[model samples]
Target: MPKSLTTSEPNVLRPEDFDPPLKRKEPIVPYYWTLDEIATELGVTSRRVGYDITGYPPRKIQPSLKAYKAGSLFLVPDADALAYIQRFRERKKS
Candidate 1:
């Protein structure tokens, strides 16, 4: 048999002898909330949510509240939705 290149025994496998284990990489995807989801959380109908998104009569218009359209579905970022909800609640208190 040819001489072993490593200092360890011919057949022995040691954890320390090998390189460090590779870490699992998680996919980086942004969180989004659908209009129905926001409506469900606020105990309202999706129609009302759409009105809020469009700043119709009765509801105060908020330019900062943004919604993105993907085909027939509209999506809002999690952070923006939470912020908008908080602001809406605060406005109601006034």
Candidate 2:
């Protein structure tokens, strides 16, 4: 007959008895801003931003302002939005 090792309490579980928990690696998500958000940040109306994108009379088209359409929603990538803002500032300076 094999002898079993005894514990102080047979019902209790010890931390040393199980393997350590795995460290979860978080995924890196890209940042994006909606047209409304961009307009709010730039202190402009959403319609003005739309005109900058699509080019209305008097307002020349800005091809650098890249916008992605997902269904009815428009999304601008963080980097692209920053670039567009920089360009707009330069245009205002000139």
Quantify all predictions' global Cα lDDT against the true fold: 0.60, 0.57
Model 2: residues with Cα > 4 Å off, grouped in runs: 1-30, 57-64
Lowest lDDT block of 10, candidate 1: 18-27
- Model 1 spans > 4 angstroms off: 1-30, 57-64
Please provide the root mean square deviation of candidate 2 (C-alpha atoms, Å). 21.2
Q: What is the C-alpha lDDT profile of model 2 across 1-94, one tens digit per residue?
A: 1234774534332223222321212212346667776676566798877776666655555544668787776777766665566555557679
Model 1, C-alpha of 2: deviation from truth (Å): 69
- CA shift at 31, candidate 1, in angstroms? 0.6
Residue 31 of model 1 has an lDDT of 71
lDDT of 1 by residue, 1-94 (tens): 2348875655433223222321212212357777877676566688877876777755675545689888877788766766655555556679
Query: Which residue pairs show collisions in model 2?
Result: none
